[model samples]
Target: MKALVLSGGAGTRLRPITHTSAKQLVPVANKPVLFYGLESIAAAGITEVGMIVGETAEEIQEAVGDGSQFGLKVTYIPQEKPLGLAHAVLIAREYLGDDDFVMYLGDNFIVGGIADLVEEFRTNRPDAQILLTQVPDPRAFGVAELDPSGQVVGLEEKPQQPKSDLALVGVYLFTPAIHDAVRSIEPSWRGELEITHAIQHLIDASAEVRSTVIKGYWKDTGNVTDMLEVNRTVLETMERRIDGEVDEASETIGRVVIEKGVRITNSRIVGPVVIAAGSEVSDSYVGPFTSVAENCRIADSELEFSIVLRDSSIRGVGRIEASLIGRHVEVTPAPVVPSAHRFVLGDHSKVQIRS
Candidate 1:
């Protein structure tokens, strides 16, 4: 089986940061969100992979060259615009050929791997198998309505009034049968060929459309809050280590990993915190659930539950919590200002003063 990962999308929700980098490349625990999906595909023993890229194609290509580092061979498929999920599949028809492929969203993070689901799909050989999970706001996502027997009987994308609370997860498994479905459906009102519509077409045609309800942690990481949350979740499972220098004045606690070339002096770090290589923490308090990326410098500051990316500096910051500082940025305390009372006694007729 092969994998088709969608790495293209105009990440409007994650602006500012997405304005500078691809949303798929957002770091969770200092690792790109796209890498997590790629790793999961590799773990499932799927090596032949095709990546769908859009406007930020060059950036994605530079970061993920041939996919050789991840034990998979990657082929770049360019999309002029993000028409829709179904459009991605339509354009990738040549790369997918006649093989069954798993479609994954690069920016999505599913805690567990897809091995189990892949096994189920291979065993049943369903025309299409989709993962669903209960979401608080179903209207914002492509929702699925189930029948009395819990079968997916209806599908809607970003509806005003959702039919069910079960929303589609970012992972999908499909056989070559889906190729025909894509061509059969026309564009939706939004002028894009939504995958939900194509899947509905298959359902209408009596195709074997199966659904699996996932209970594990999953996130699209489309915004700052979700990015921070995913980072915290991944950090919770990290192992403890001290590979670099820690001065006698420095103190390390809990599950902390100091990568090689990291240097800590007179700082107190409480894990699960990760200090990447070439990072230096001096005279600071590095609190829990934080990741200091490579070449970053944190001096005379206090940080907790934050992610400081490569070459960034946070010195004399007083205190910072729950922030995503981008690469090569500098964060320091604002200048001090004096507060005093000035006297102005000039009114002659009816001047009133209270002290």
Candidate 2:
């Protein structure tokens, strides 16, 4: 089986950051969310991937570069626009051919990977198999309705009246029989051919469409809150390893990975934190669940439960928590003499002040 990974959506939810970089490329725990999906696919023994990309195709291509790093041969499939999940499959028909394939959303993170799910599909070879999870709010995701016997009966994309709390997860297994299903469906009111509709078509046609309600951790890192949450979740499993220079005045507790070339002086770093290479943290409190990327500098600040991207600097800022800082950005305290608040924020930026 092959893999079709969708990396083309315009992430309006993660505005300002997504405005500059691909949503899938956003880092969680200092690693791109897309990388996790690719790694999962590779681990599932899928060696060929057709990466569906959009406006940020060039950036994705540069980063993935033939996919040899992940033991996969990747073919870049350019999608002029992100029509829908089903539209992606429609265009990738040539690359997918007649082989059974998996469709994975690049920004979704699922703990424990999809190796078992792939094996289950291989054994049953259902027409389509979708992963579902109970969500507090099902209106924001595709909803699945099941029959009394636990069989999938109906599906809807972001329905106003959800039939169930089970939201479709980003990973899906499908056979070549899905080609006809996509061709048979019409675009929804959202002006896109949603994958949920395609799957429903299979159900209506009496084709075997199965689902597994997963109890594992799964998140769509589309917005800042979920991104930070996924970061914290991944960091919690990290092992403590300090390869950098920490002066006598500095102290570290818990699971912290200080990459090589990092220098920490007079700082207190809590556990589940990772300071990447060439970063300098001086007179700062690097709290838990924080990921400071390579070449960053943190001085005289307190940061916790946040992700600071590469080449960014946070100096003299009182505190930062539950945030996602973009790359090459600078965070500094305002002039005390001004006695006025000032901000140079980008479009769709959200900031909360401690009045």
Candidate 3:
């Protein structure tokens, strides 16, 4: 089976960060989210992969290269616009011709990987299979409704009134029969061909459709909050490895991975934290669940539960938490100004002032 990885969406939720960088390229624990998906595909023993890319195609191509690093031969299928999931399949028809494939969202993170799901799909050979997980807000995602026999009976995308809590996870398996289904469906109200609609079309035609409710961890790292959460989740499994230099004045706590060429002096770092190579942390408190990317400098500052991208510096700053700092940025103490309170009192106005 082959793989089709979608990396083409404009991540509006990620805001200013996605303005300059691809959302899929955002690092979780110093590794791009897209890399994790690629690794999972390779682990599933799929070698030929097609990546659907949009305006950020150049950046994605540069990062992934030929995909040999992940043991897959990648073909980049450019999408002028991110119309919808079904539109992606429609455009990649030539690349995915006649082959059963798994569609993975590049920015989505699933803890246990899709090896078991792929294996199950290969064995059962359903016309289409979707991974579902119970979400707190089903209205924000494509939802599924199953029959009494656990068969998928209907699907809807971001419905106003959801019928179930089962949100479609970002991984899907489909056979060649889906091409006809996609061709038969029209665009949704959102002006795009929704994948949920295509799957629903299959259901109406009596084609075999299946759904699996995954119990493991799964997240779509589209926004900053989810990105940080995914980073924290991935760091929880980190092994303690200190390849960098830690001075006698520094105290490093549990499950910290300090990469080579890093220097820590007179600082305290609490882990599940990862300090990448070429970074220096001096007289700083790098708290738990933080990832300081390569070539960053943290001096006389305190940071926790944050991600600092490459070449950024946080010097002489106060505590910062639950943040996503972009690359080559600087966070330092602001210049002090004379303190004063100036006010014009109106007639019959009562005022209290501290002297």
Candidate 4:
């Protein structure tokens, strides 16, 4: 089976950051989210793959060139626009001709991987197989309602009134028959043909559509909140190692990894943290659940539960938590000045005084 990884969507939810970078390339535990999907697919024994990319095609092309790094040969399939998941299937028809394929959304994080799912699909060979999980807000995702016989009876995308808490996870397995299903459906009210609609077409036509509800952790890292949460989750499982430099004056606590070329001096770093290459932490406190990327500088600052990208700096800042700081950025204390009283008094005796 071939793997079709979707990296095309314009991530509007992760704005400001996505404005400059692709959402799939966002780091969790110092590795890109898309890389996790590629590696997982490789481990599943799928090597012939295609990646669907959008305006940020060049960025992905550079990072995943030829896909040989992950033991896969990749073909770049460009989607002019991120119309819908159905549209992606439509465009990749030639590459996926007559073969079963697994479609993975780039920004989705699935803990415990999809190895078992692939094995099940290969054995059963269903027309379509979807991964489902019980989410608190089913209306926010593609939801599936089951029949009394445990079959998928209905599916809806971001519906206002959802029928079930079972949200469709980002991974899907489909047979060649799905090509006709995509062509048979009309665009939805959103002006694009949704994959859910296409899958519904298959179900209505009596095609076998199976679903597996997972108990493992899964997240669509489409926003800052989810991104940070995934980062923390991945960091929690990091193996304990100190592979790089640490000065005598620096105290390296449990499970800290200082990558090659990293220098730490006069700093207190508690781990389950990774400090990337060429980064220097001097006179700072680098706490747990944080990843400091390459060529960064942290001086006289304290950071915890945060992610700092390459070429960034944090100096003289008191503390930071649960932040996703971008590349080439700087965070430092504001200018110090003499104290002066400034007060505001409002109704009900509400007052804020700043000095």
lDDT of 4 by residue, 45-137 (tens): 899998999999999999899999999999999999998999999999999999999999999999988999999999999999999999998
Clashing pairs in 3: none
* Model 1 agreement with the true structure over 269-348: per-residue lDDT tens digits: 99999999999999999999898899999999999998888899998978999888888899888898886556666667
- Stretches > 4 Å off in candidate 2: 337-355
lDDT of 3 by residue, 193-232 (tens): 9999999999999999989999999999999999999999
> What's the lDDT of the predicted structure labeled candidate 4?
0.92
lDDT of 3: 0.96
Task: Please write out the lDDT profile of model 2 over residues 172-250, one tens digit for every residue.
Answer: 9999999999998999898999999999999989999999999999999999999999999999999999999999999
TM-score of each: 0.95, 0.95, 0.98, 0.95
lDDT score at residue 90, model 4, on the 0-100 scale: 97
TM-score of 3: 0.98
Q: Residue 246 of model 1: what lDDT?
A: 98
Model 3 alpha-carbon miss at residue 15, Å: 1.7
